[model samples]
Structure formats: C-alpha cells, structure tokens
Target: MTTTTPDMAPVRLYGAEHAADPERSYELLRAQGPVALAEAAPGFVVHLVTDYRAALDLLHDTETWSKDTRPWQSRVPESSSISQPTQWRPNVIFADGENHAHLRRVITDCFGLLDPHEVRTLTFRHADTLLSAFADAGTVDLVAQYATQLPLMVFNSLFGMPDEYGPRLVEMLAAMVGSDPARAGEGAQAFGAYLAGLYETKAAQRGDDLTSWFIDHPNGLDREEATQQILLTLGAGNEPTANLIANTCVRMLSDDRYFGTLTTGSLPVQHAIDDALWNDSPVANYSFHTARRDVTFHGTRIPAGAPVMISYAAANTCPHQGVPADGFRSGNKAHLAFAAGPHACPARDLALLIATAAIERLATYLPDITLAVPVEELTYKEGTIHRTLTALPARFTPLAPDADGATPWSRSSADRGSAGSPRTAPQTGAMASAP
Candidate 1:
C-alpha cells in the first residue's frame, strides 16, 4: 500500500487541474492507498478515503466515528474556505446520536408533509419563468440562467418566501460554497441574517410552507434550531441539485447512446440522471467525520479525532467494480451520491424530483439544444465539496411565445405582467462561478 512520511507534501485538492479532471486526481490519491492524505486548503492535510469498500465501511460504522468537527476545527485556520462547510453547527450534519435523530426526524417529517405533485408543479413553474427569460435566445448558458436559479426559486416558494428572494439567496449560497475566503465569510454572514429574517417573519405570521411547519412542529424547535434546519436544507439542496441538472443535461446531449435513447423515447430520463450520479456525482468529496477515538481504518492508523472525508466521486467510479454487459448504469441507485447509512441525505427524493422536473421541462421546450462548446472544453469550478460547472453554454432553436399565448412560457410571462412585476431576464454572466 502507498504510504506517506511526515515530510511528504499532501496532494492539493483545490485548483483548476483538480476541478477539471477529478478522476485523475482520485487515481493519484488511490495510489497512496484507500485512505490517503490530501491538502484541502493551504496547510490542512485531510485524510481522504478513495476505495469504495473502505468508504462504505466508514459510512456504515458510525459508532467509531463522530460527526462533530469541534476538535478538528481547532487545527484548521478559522479563515480558511474549507472551514466554512465543516464548522460546527448544531444541525443534523454535525450532531451525533439522539440529537441527530431528533433533528433528522423533524426534517424528514417536514419533508414528508410536502406533496410530490406540488413540488413538481413548483419546479415546473420556476423552470418556465427562468426559460421565458432566454427561451427566445438561440444561445444560452444553462448553468448560469436555468440550472443554478431554478432550485433556489422552487425552494423560496416552498419556504413561504416571495419569488423575489430567489436571486439574493442564490448569491449568498454561491459565495458561501465558493473557494474565495472573503466571499465565503461574507456569504455565511448574509445567509445567517437572511434565515433570521425568515424566522422573524414566520413567527409573526405562520404560512403554509416548510418554514412555518418547522416553527410549529411538535418537536418544538426554538428559533435557532428551526433556522439551522432550513439552512441545511437549502444550502445542501440548491447547489448539488443544480449541478445534477446541468451534468445530466450534458450527459444526455453529448453521448450518442443517451441522445438516441432520449430522441426515440426508448430510455427514460431517470436513466441519464442515474448515470450522472454514478459517474459525475455532484458532491465530489464530503461527509467529513472525526474519529471518536484512536482507530485503525482499512489497514491505516488514524489518530483520535483526526478528520476523514469520503470521496463519493472516487468511490462511485472505483475501478474494481463490475460493469453491466450493456455498458450502462441506468436504474442503479447503489451509488453513494447522497452518501449512506444514518447520515444519508434526507432530501434525496426531493432533490431527484426537482432535478427530473427541471430537466424534463427544459427538454420539452428546447428539444434540439446542443452544447455550444465541445464537451471536452467544459471546466468545473474549484472547490473541494462540489463538482460544479463554470458554465454550460448551450445553443437551441429560438422558441417564441405562441401567437395565441398557449405555451407555458407565454402564460408565465402574462401572469407576471398582470402581477405588476414582470420578471426580467437575469443578467448573463451575473451568476456566481461556484455554489
């Protein structure tokens, strides 16, 4: 097995090279062993688990691991971009044992209250509004205009906020997840303030939305508890879901097999989505855990409270796995894109619903859309936690509002105009590079 000396410099995980071709980076890390070292920031060497079996073992063996990051944070600089996501919060992601279960139940129950049909309808509605802005433009950046903003708008409607709140929320979340230290700091602060205002509004007047339900749940979470849960849901839901939509679109359009299947209606859209999850998991490497005590994992010795991260991308594409005879991964949900075990993403179903709806809606309107740049030229944004495209330039036939105004895009524009607040097209290139 590959090993490292104390003087060995850890592999850098944040840069254009790593983001552009993470599979190569994973291969380098795997040469060091299933559990190898990588530099997450300038000086922080985090243990990254690359083997599929090893990752599953860690995800499933929670008793030996703790979700809390308090001990590990002491070693990381407070100003580092890597610190923002891993910083201790009392939410489900950081809590352990009964507290985790308690918070998780509240979130699950709240989500359970959501109607899947309504969620799809909300997704379709937002997709139309976003598309209406650029549906007539022959060339559009799907990443900047459509995929990035649709989820936040759907989330805003679900959380009992006016549609106007979507743009600023997008900015705040993008900055928080980006690699820039200063922007991440400011994003975190803005996000907290935004949530605080949301809670204040819901407390005064309850609405039929997730925020209101969270505030009034039987679990009886205080303002901070409820707000933290919302933060986790939106922050976790938006960027990854956006990436999934864009990634799936790219996959379906670029690959001839998927193109033929989609055009002939022989394969369902979910097939392409699952393939993307297995191959290009939106959340590349995350699910940080600290050792509960000194432990030896997968033949490697890890000290007490040392930080270990699971590479979902590396594990999903693990070279040892058996491939289907047909060379397709459709209908396989075994990948750890949403992670696994007790801490698996609770919003898995909702995220899938939103992503599927967004893709379907776009496909219906722009059936001939193709990548503006060759697929090989696409670049991902630099960040350790997510695999985000810097831009997805696409060209499609210009779709104009029907003369009778029967199309969804036309109807949506008409409704907005009647509301005395027409939705303007978001500025091209205004979208933040990473979220």
Candidate 2:
C-alpha cells in the first residue's frame, strides 16, 4: 500500500496546478490510501475520501458523519474563509435528520411539479438564445458565450425572475463562489437580499414557476426558508450545469470518437454527457461531511469535527478493483456524478435534461464546430469544488439567422426574433496555461 511519511508535506488544493489538473493530485492522494489527508485551504486540513466504496459508505452514514460545520466554529476563526457556514440559512444541504428531510421534501416537491418536457423546452430556448449571440463569429469562446449563460437563464425563468434580474444574479453567484476574500461575503449578502425580494414578489403574485410552487407548497416554508431553498437550488444548479455543457461540448469537438459518431448519427448526446460525468464531473470534489466523532477506517484516522470531502473525480476514475480510468460503462448509471445516498442531488433529472438539451442544440446548430485551440490548451477554473473551464474557444461555420429568426431547434414563437440574432463575440485569451 502507498504511504506518506511525516516528512512529506500534504498536497495543497489551493494552487493553480491543482485547479488545472486535479486528477493528477487525486492520483497522488489515492496512492497514499483511500482516505488521504490534505490541506484544502490555509489551516484547513481535510480527509480526502478517494475510494468509491469508502465514499459511498461515508455518504450514507449520516449518523457517523454530519454536514454541519459548526464543530469547526471554535477551531476556525469566523474571519477565515473555511469557517463560512456551509448553509447560509436552514436549507437541505447543511441540515440533518428531520430538518433535512423536511427541507428536502419541500424543494423536491417543487422540483417534481416541474414538467420535464417544459424544462427541456425552456433549456432549448435558452441554449438557442445564448448561441445566437455568438453564432456569427466563426471563433467563439463557448464557455462565456454559451455554457455560462444557458443555465443561469433557465434558472432565472424557472424562478420567475425578471429578465433584468438574470445578469445581476449571475454576477452575485460568481462573486460568492469566487476566491476573492473581500467580495465573497458581499456577494452572499447581495444574493440573499435578491432572494428576499424575489420571495416577496412571488408571495404577492404567485406565478406558474418553481418559486411560486415553494410558496404554495403544503410545507408552508417561511420567507427565510423559501429564500434559502431558492439559493440552494440556484447555487447547486448553475455552475454544475454550465460545466457539464462546456465539458461535453469540448469532448464533442476534440474527440474524434464522439465527433465521428455525431456525423454518422450513431452516438446519442446523452452518451457523451454520461461519459463526461464519469470522466470529469463538474463538481469534482465536494459533499463535505464532518466526522461526528473520532473514527478510524480504511487504514486512516479521522478525528471528530474533522472535515472529510468526497473526491468524486478520483472515485469515478479510480483504477482500483479493476475499474477503468474512464470508468465502467455497463449501461448502468452507477457513476457518482450526481452523488448518492439520501443527500444526492435532487435536481438530477432536471440537470441532465438541461445539459442534454444544451448539447443537443449545439450539435444541431453547429454541426461543423471544432475547437479553436488545442485540447491541451484548455484550462479549468480555479476552485476546489467545481471543475469548470475558464473558456472553450471553438471555430464553426457561422449560420445565417433562420427565416423566422429562430434557431433550428427552437419550437416556440416566443423563442424567436432578436434573441437568436448574431452579435459580436466576447474577447478571449483569458484561459490559463496548460499544465
């Protein structure tokens, strides 16, 4: 078994190298053991669970592990970024036991009420709208021009936010998730305030949207509860969906296996999406579970209150037990991309629909699309939780606006007109140097 001597320093997850190529770091950790200790941020040491079975066991054992980070309050100063509460409010992600069930039920019920067909239709419309803005430019950054905006627009429509609110919401979420110490708190507060206003608007005029459903649900969530739940949903939905689309598109563009099948009409978009999930999940390492008490398992010791993170990317790609590096594809959805156990992502279906629709639309509209830069030149965003591209530059044959001013995939008149018109491409050359 691989082992780390005390003289060897723990792997740091904060550097540009880790962000660019975390799989390599995960491989190093997996070599140490299934459960390798690493420093996530300054002064924050976490047990990184790199084994698939071990991660599942810990995820399902809420009694032994809790999502609450309050245990670290005394140890980590309030000013420390790591000390930030996992749950800004009493929402499902950080809740436990009965509270978790109650909050999850409310959110799940709201999401369940969403018609999958409607979700797909909305996703297609948003994809078309985003693509239209850069379709005229033969060279475009897919990450900024398409992937980043589609999910945000879809969530905005689902939450019944005004068109004007979408950009601000995106800005706020970017700040909250970004590494800027000064802006993170400000972004959090601004997001909360925006949600509060949304709650008020939905209360006064309940519309046919997810926000309205939360208000009308039997759970009778208070304003604060409703706002927190919305935050959780939007926060959980946007970045992952964006990354999934960008990743899948990159695969479709760079890999001849996928591109060849696309031209032959043999491979499904879902197949590409599933492959991306197994290979490079958007949320690479997350689901932070703190030890309820001192524990030793998998030849590693973890103290009570110590943070344990599930390395989704490592576990999925783990070669142990004869699993392939690309993950097993037995036509089974066993991959932990959406996670597992009771706390698995509630919007799994919706997220898949959104991603599949976005990719399908791209393939339909830009059949000739290809990567503008070498596949090796792409860079991932700098963060621990998300594995997202900073930019995805691609070259494609620019298409003229349809006669109806709608993308070929657009099915509704409401999705027509200037929204699908060509516009100037965004500036590029911001992606990081490849490792």
Candidate 3:
C-alpha cells in the first residue's frame, strides 16, 4: 500500500515572546510553503493561504472556495449574549454567486456615480476652506483635524445629509470596528440602531439620495434590510477612506522626495495614490473565509470546510505576481490592504478617487507645507485589519507671490481646523519618558 498525506503542522502567527507583525507573520508562512493547515478551533481546522499567488488562486476560485456559507446560524451568532441564531443583515461581500453580484450592482449604481473631476474640484474647494483655518497656526494634529473629518464631509453629499452628522458617525464607527472586536461589536450594535431610525425617516421622503433608491428598491428592501446595508456600508466605507488620506500624508511627510515629487508635479493625483496604495495601505486585512471543498496550494492539502485568513497586506507586496497586470510596475506592487478575489473591496473606485483628490489638492496648493514634527515622531496605527495615524503634527507657511500681485492665500493655500492645543511632537528623549 502506498499512502501520502499533505504536510500539516502547527505554525503560530504570534510567537509567545512577540506579537505578530503582518510582514513577519507572512514571511514565516511563505517559508513553510504557500498553504498550511491551521487549527482554527480545537479538533477543527482551516487552511491558511499566506503567499500571494496561492491566495489569489483560492480567492478567485469560487467553485472550490465558496463564500456562500449558508446554514451559518449555529456558526456565526450575532453576539455571545444574544440567544438569537444570527442577524439578518449580510453585506454583499459576505454572499456568494449571483446574490453577491446582484447586490453589488445595485449599491454601485446608488453611490458610485460621482464624477472624478467634480470630486477633485470639491476636494480643492474643501481643502482651501480647511487650510485657511490653520494657515497662521504653526502646528496641528493632522489626524483629528483633517484626516478624520474630510472623507465624512466629502461622502456626506452622497447620502445628502448635513456634514454635521459626519463627526458623530465617525466616533460611533471608530468604537465599533477599527481594532477592538468586542468594543467594535458594541459600537456596531449602537450604530445599527441609529441607522434603523435614520432609514425609516428617509424612507418616508424617498429623496434622491442613497436612502431613496435603497429604501424602496424595486428589487426589495424593507426598513431592517435597508438599515443593515447602510450600517455595513458606513462602517466599511468611511474609516478606510479617512485612513487612506491620513496614511498618504504620513508616508509623504516621511520622505521629502516623495512629497517633492507630488508638489513638483512629477506625480499626478492618481500616481500619488498608486504610490501610497503600494507603500502605505490603510485597511490592511479582510474578513476570514472558509474553504467549501478540498483544495491544495503548493502541494499542501486543505480539507473541506476550513477557515482561511487571506493576507491582503502580504499579497500586495509580492515581487512577481501582485496586483492586476495593468497596475503593477515591474510587477512589484503595494500591500493588499484591500483583499483580492471574491471579497475584493467594492468601494475601491470611490476610495481611490477620494484619496487622490485630497492628495492632489494638497500637493498643488500647499507645496511648502511641512510637518511641524519630524516623521519619526509619528505613531503609525497598525493591526489585523486597519492602518491609520493617531496624529500627524504639521505646520505650513504659504509662499509670498511674484510681481503678478496674485494674493498668495487665493492661489497658494487655504483651510485649517480644530483649535486644540497645537500638537507639536515632543523631543525624542522627552517622548520616551513621558506617558
């Protein structure tokens, strides 16, 4: 008798001595080979697809790796406290086959119609107003003042609401999902309740904003369903976007050459985004998935019904086969901060545009703007799913104009925000000891 079994061993992402760094964790997986078996639970298992090529193989292979995990009631309960089997709201990303495709199409039509040129224009106008507020101020917290506030303001129009709600929503969602799962679930529930109220209000009017189409869809969406979709969208859409802008600024500020390239017009808005997407991806993880059937990667066998954590962050940096063919330069690419395959982010187009608009506006207008503190002072937010900044202290002095008599404020620079104590970074030695 000849018998052969795939290699299945214990490989821990987090060693007892050190927390798992995404980059380091991935390299370990790569060294072990493309795919490895992980014990997701005692006596239960899932495949861990760690390498870029193998991940893409599994992600796009819907037949072998299905997203349709029906009969999930006993599996993914709403909350540990709740006796209820499951919440009825599942985003399109969680669905598989035609159902997923259909939902994505409807949502895209509802909110994806913005003209890029107009977005860019709006970004410039908003930047002008925001920059003007802080031009005189020598320093400010970039995250609290600008990064967190901007996308909420920009995306608010899509829903046709007052920018006033953006701050509240941002706060609630921040608590709900960024890193802390338990706290985030609490926040998610609260936000869900608020969304239910808001959707009911919008349904009555059936206005032209996102609510109208979503609420009374000919296809069908009741108050509960509509609320769930909206809640999911808001959570999924905003933070990554805000983080994207914040990340871009952080990366550029780290190196004068990167900033100079943008300010000098060597890089357009889109190019800057591409550079950042590769260098400083914002949302660095996607939800875990399960393999529906037996599959193999690099000769590693994955039995049916196993959970898999696809490393989008790892896949993005693959030297040979990362990103789509068209986007990769030298086939070297950025982090898969967004995942690939079936659950690839649906709002990618909008996120990229919004980010580019922010960058272009800043680069074109505030060429001389510089961070008040050195980039080393920054604390980069990193975790299983999100990457953002706690703060980026910055100061800007607009350039004096030529003989043309053009007011420097009009052509040169614009908005500033949040009159907090100017958040200058402490000196290295001082920062090391304080707090």
Candidate maximizing TM-score:
1
Pairs clashing in candidate 1?
A: none
Ranking of models by TM-score: 1, 2, 3
Residue 212, candidate 1: alpha-carbon lDDT = 94
How does candidate 2 score on lDDT?
0.77
Model 1: lowest-lDDT 10 consecutive positions: 426-435
| lDDT over C-alpha atoms for residue 416 of model 3 | 20
lDDT per residue as tens, model 1, 1-435:
666445556777888888877888888888888888888877788889988899989988879999999987977766665676888998999999999999999999999999999999999888988888998887899999999999999998899999888888988987886668799789989988889889999999999899999998898899889989998889788889999999988886787655542225435568888999999999998999999989878767888989989999999988755787654787879899999999999999999999999887777666667788999999888878888989999986566664444564433444334332222222221111100
The sequence of per-residue lDDT tens digits that candidate 3 reaches over residues 225-336 is: 5665676666667778888887767655554335543314333335445556765567554456656776665676656665565655556654564346644342233346
**Global Cα lDDT for candidate 1:** 0.82
State the C-alpha lDDT per candidate: 0.82, 0.77, 0.57
- Give me the runs in candidate 2 sitting further than 4 Å from their true place: 1-8, 73-88, 177-190, 261-263, 320-330, 406-435
Model 3 C-alpha lDDT versus the unseen true structure? 0.57
